[model samples]
Target chain A: MEQRKATIRTACVEALPLAIAIAAYGLSYGVLATQVDFNALTAVLMSVLVFSGSAQLVAVAMLAGGAGLTSVLLTVVLLNLRNLLYGAALADGLGPAKKWTSLLAFGITDEPFVLASSRFQKVGPDPLYFAVVAGIFYIAWIFSSLTGALIGDHLDPQKFGLDLAFPVTFAALLVPGLKGKPVIGTALAAVLMALCLEWFKPGNELTIIITGLLAPLVGLFMHRRSDHG
Target chain B: MVNQWILIGVLAVATYVSRVLGLTVMAGRELNPAVRLYFNYVPTAIIVALIVKQIFIPSGGHLVLSLPVLAACLAGALAILLFKKFLPSVVAGVVVGLLVRYFL
Candidate 1:
């Protein structure tokens, strides 16, 4: 129990930076959801259920564009497809556990996965600790969205530089993981895809899905050829 | 009024479907090696993708040539990478973004 407490404490401490980013981004999503016609309940529920920052951004954009239900579903599913990749990486780190623990895997996100997977290598995969981190971030996100939704369109986040939080949080999460050529190539491809897609598919979430799916293929092919040669 | 509620309900279910499908299907399985390799690297790809969009394109068809945003974000990344301190990096980025938005 003492070891468990320590692990949870350490996980929470390490997760603080990501927690702030999630809260700030969630708030923005909630406010935007309201402006896009979702009421408070729907807005909050989306954040709790989806819990993906970029997908939520795309969701409101679709809502604003009067996208049909099928289109919205396709767009959101594609935008968040990366979470499957995230979940797959995370499953290995889950350690020896029972079937019931799988419930916590549903709440997995970028921050918790990174923290848990990296630490699990050393800590031996405490599901309780991972669950604690996920729960903290999940609560922070839901409440932050609620706060922002209630605040409505009055506050200017651009003035407070909230937009910058997304990039900064992303950078902090990304840089430490840039280890090799294939990874760098994948990043470059993703960047190129994002830029090019913006020209044609403005506000569409499919760009993320396409870029994420393709970049790794480019990386893997290059890696294999280079390895053989 | 009812129409709006209906739309919201549809979106809510759609969003839930996306999330639940991934979680339920992929949970408790060992990832194929190729997919595992991709997951390890894709986070960087996703972040770089988003960052490139922000630095080059700020609005609809309007490019902001604001060097401050770029410099600040770079500085923030550098600080966190160097010191492993996230809050300071966050402050650096937030300060730079606000300064560029306000003064520039």
Candidate 2:
């Protein structure tokens, strides 16, 4: 019990800044969802359960566009494909955790995952730590969404093009990580897929799925070829 | 309203399913070296794709030769060069973007 208390305390201290940044993003998302007419309950639920800002933003955009259910689902799934890699990489760290650890892992979004993964390596596996960080993020997201919903549609940011937050954030994230051909190639593949979808029959979400699946394959093939040479 | 709920449900399930699938495939095992190497670059690729689509091509229909967006990008680039912090650069970009929109 003392060990658990120590773990939780350590996790909270580390998770503080991440919780703030993530909460800010969630608050912005809540504001946007409310402006788009999503009820407070729906908005809060999505943030708490979906817990993926990129996927949720894409889903909301498609919803505003009157996109079909199939399109929305596909877009979200494609956007979240990276979580697959995140989950896999994190699996080893979770090896010593209890069976109930999966519940905490469910809340492992980008920020917490990075922070938790880094700390988990140094401290050894601790489910309580993961739980503490995930819980903080989950609560922040839900409350922010709830707050946004209650504020109603009075503060619409779309007119100012604030709807571009996702893309902007993604852009900022992208500029730093392009170190090699593998990264460059996958980005090119995604761009090509999006362009083709936009210009041609408009595959909507399938474009994301296709690109998400293919980009990694391209990276794998390039790595193999480079190895052979 | 109901549609929003539906979208929420679909997105939640889709996100969860992908996570579950990933966890299962890598369950109780170390990641393949090849796979691990590629995973290192996925975040960069995803973010780049997102930014290109968002900042460069705001309107879905066409890529406008956007001076304001370009200016904002430059400002953001400078912020990054100076501070080396992601949020500061982004905030700089957004503030510059808003200014550009308001003035020009």
Candidate 3:
């Protein structure tokens, strides 16, 4: 019992910083969702249910851009594809949790994956620790989303410049991950492809899905080239 | 409202299935290196595409660069690069974007 308590405490301390970051993004997400017509209830509920920062933000942004339901769903699926890798990487560490692994899988997004994978590497499989960290982040994400939604509900999106929040928030999220040549190549390819598609037909629905499908191949090619050199 | 609910339901199921499949079906399996690299780069691609879509807005059957959006994204990018923080960077971007909107 004491050991379990210690694990929980350690997890809380470690997860706190990331949890705060998640909250900040969640707040932004909540506000953005509202700009796209999501009320407080639906916005918070999306956070409660989807629990994915990239997927949710992308969905709202796409919707605001006048994307249809199919397009939004397709984009989300593309975004969620990485969860497969994260899950595969984390499976062994979470294997010891038995049936509980299914429940724990709900928290398999980026931040949790990073923290849990590092913890697993250092001390072996620790589902309890994973649970603690995920739980803290989950609470932070949900509550901050609610708070942001409520706050956004009252304000005029344009007057307060909340309309600018979508691009800015995405830029903030995208900038930190811009490391290494291959990743940078992928982003540049995506930008060019998206620009071409949009230029061909303004507000074209195919731009996002097509760019998402093709641009990553550039990254793969670069990665293989670097590997052989 | 119903559409939103349906969207949420579909997203929840889709997201959970991806998570569970990795832990169960794909567990202990070695993904091909090429496939892994592709998967790894997908987010960067998708995020960049999303940002591009925002930066270039559609108007009257043609695309026009929205300076405010572009400025906001640039400011946001600069802030994140300098401070390495999320919220503040977003705030800085929005503030700059708003200033540009007001002045120009």
Compare the candidates by TM-score and give the number of the best one.
3
Is 1 or 3 the stronger prediction by TM-score? 3
DockQ for candidate 3? 0.79
The lDDT leader among the candidates is 3
RMSD of each: 5.6, 3.9, 1.2
lDDT (10s digit) by residue, model 3, range A1-229:
9988998998999999999999999999888888888899999999999999888999988888888888888888888888999999999899889999999999999999999999899989999999999999999999999999998899998898998998999899988888999999999999999999989988888898999899999998998899999
Model 2 residue A86 lDDT?
A: 72
Q: After best superposition, candidate 1 residue A3: deviation in angstroms?
A: 10
lDDT of 3 by residue, B1-104 (tens): 22889888888988999999989888899899888889888888888888898888888888889899999999999999999989889999999999999999
Taken over the whole model, the C-alpha lDDT of each candidate is 0.66, 0.65, 0.91
Q: Which rank order by TM-score, best down to worst?
A: 3, 2, 1
Model 2 segments more than 4 A misplaced: A61-67, A89-99, A147-152, A164-166, A179-181, A196-206, A217-229, B22-25, B36-91, B102-104
Residue A65 displacement (Å), model 3: 0.5
- Residues A52-143, candidate 2, lDDT per residue (tens digit)? 87677556645544457886676566566667777776676666776765666686567767877887689777667777888888887778
Those runs of model 1 whose alpha carbons end farther than 4 Å from true positions after fitting are A1-43, A53-105, A111-133, A147-154, A161-173, A197-209, A225-229, B1-31, B39-43, B58-91, B101-104
Tens digits of per-residue lDDT for model 1 on A1-229?
8887787788789888788977876766666666666667877877776666655665564444345556555555554566676565556556454574556765666677778878877867577777888888888989988887886555565666655655665576567677677887787788788777766655455555567667777777667777888
TM-score of each: 0.63, 0.77, 0.98
Q: Can you list the residue pairs that collide in candidate 1? A: none
Q: Which candidate order results from sorting by lDDT in descending order? A: 3, 1, 2
